[model samples]
Every structure is written in structure tokens, then in C-alpha cells.
Target: MPNSPSAKKALRKSQKRRLVNRSNRSALRTNLKKARVAVEGQPSEAADDVKTAMRHLDISAGRGLIHKNKAARLKSRLAKKLNAALTES
Candidate 1:
């Protein structure tokens, strides 16, 4: 339905960007899951897992795969979990 060449190219670029963003989001979810599980099971590694999750979140936010506020909220939650783990230990 793109009448102009620029419109066609834009559509193609958007599609490609969407696919890449989806993959990045999936990866971010995976990393977050890993961090949560690590914190739940092995409290000692929670800090490191949290750091890794934060890095992934920052990357996703930078790429526009997720909102910056959402990313910050996730990071905050992870840090809270880490703190709880520390307190429990």
C-alpha cells in the first residue's frame, strides 16, 4: 500500500526494526528472569545478577525496545529484591 519509494523503504525499515526490538525485549526478559531466579535461590549472587539485569535494561532502553521509566522501575525492583535477600542472609 506504499505508493512512494520512500514509504516502501520506511515500511521495510520499520519491519526490520520491529523484529530486532522484539528480540531485544525477549533477551531482556530472559535476563530479568535469570536475575530473579538467582536472587530467589542464591542470595549471594543476587547483587551480580542485579547488575547484569540492569545492564540489559539500560541497553533495551537505549535501543527504544522499552521505556526508560519502565526500565528504571524494573531495576529498582531488582535492587529491592537484592536488599531483601541481603537482609534475610
Candidate 2:
């Protein structure tokens, strides 16, 4: 429904960006889930998984895909979970 040529081009560009962003967001979520699972099920590997998840979160925050504060909060929660798991065993 873009009337002008420029508008059409912009729409196309937005669509491409949407797809890329979606993929990145999905990957981030997957990493977070994996980290949570590792923390709960395999404390031995939780540290590495948490590290990878934190790195992904930092990258996503830097790229403006997620808010910096939210990323920090997630990192904090994950760290807490990892620490708790470690302390238990």
C-alpha cells in the first residue's frame, strides 16, 4: 500500500530489517532458555552457558535489539541462579 516509489523502497527495507531482527531476537531467546536449563539441570555446565547467554545479551543490547537495563536485569537474574545452583552443590 505504499503509494510513492520511495515509500515502496522504504517498506522493502523495513521488511528486511524486520526479518533480521526477528532472527536475532529468536537466537537471543534460545540462548537464554539454554542457560536457564543448564542452571537447573546441569550445574556443571551452567557457568559456560550463562557466559554465552550474557555475551549474547550484551551484543543484543549494544545493537539496540533489547534495552540495556533489561539486559542487565537478565544478566543479574542469571548470575543469581547460577550462584544458587553452584552453592547447592
Candidate 3:
């Protein structure tokens, strides 16, 4: 338990931040999943999803919700999948 008033306030702020981060993280994961599914389904459809997902990833990374390197890696993998799908079709 927080003993000081400042500590109590800090705890409250932390809880709020945690909730916000959780919501944002959930959104990010959902966007990533949508992108992956679209990439697996059709290259044309995947383009928009990938772009949206990448945008979300960038925002999340910038906000410290996710690691920048992981975001870059995911974007790379998505692009690779998109390229492969385009070539295959």
C-alpha cells in the first residue's frame, strides 16, 4: 500500500496508464492479426491492411507500448509475405 499522498497519486496514475496501455496493445495485436490474415488471403487486400498495421505499430512503438525493433521486424515480415503473395499470384 502507498503510505504517502504522492505515492498514492502515483499508484493511481500507474493504474490509468496500465489500462490505456492494455487497450492500445490489444488494438495493436488485432491490427497485426488482421494484416497477417489479409496477407495470407490476398496480396491486393493485404496492402491496405499492412499499411494500417504498420501505422499502428509505429504509433505504438513511439508511445512505448511496443519495442521499435519488434515493430520493424513485424513490418519486414509482413512486407516479405506480401511480396511473396504478389509474386505467387
lDDT for each candidate structure: 0.91, 0.97, 0.93
- Candidate 2: where are CA atoms >4 Å away? none
RMSD of 1: 1.0
Of 1 and 3, which scores higher on lDDT?
Answer: 3
lDDT of 1 by residue, 1-89 (tens): 89999999999999999898888888889999999999999989677878999999998889878899999999999999988988999
What would the TM-scores of all predictions be? 0.93, 0.96, 0.97
Per-residue lDDT of 1-85 in model 3, one digit per residue for the tens? 9999999999999999999999999999999999999988877778999999999999999999989999899889888989999
Clashes of 2: 0
State which candidate, 1 or 2, has the greater TM-score.
2
Which parts of model 3 have CA positions greater than 4 angstroms off?
none
Q: Which residue pairs come into collision in candidate 3?
A: none
How much does candidate 1 score in TM-score? 0.93
Candidate 2, residues 1-89: lDDT per residue as tens digits?
Answer: 99999999999999999999999999999999999999999997788999999999999999999999999999999999999999999
**Residue 18 in candidate 3, Cα distance off native in Å:** 0.4
Q: Model 1 lDDT vs. the true structure?
A: 0.91
RMSD of each: 1.0, 0.8, 0.7
Rank ordering of all candidates by TM-score, starting from the highest: 3, 2, 1
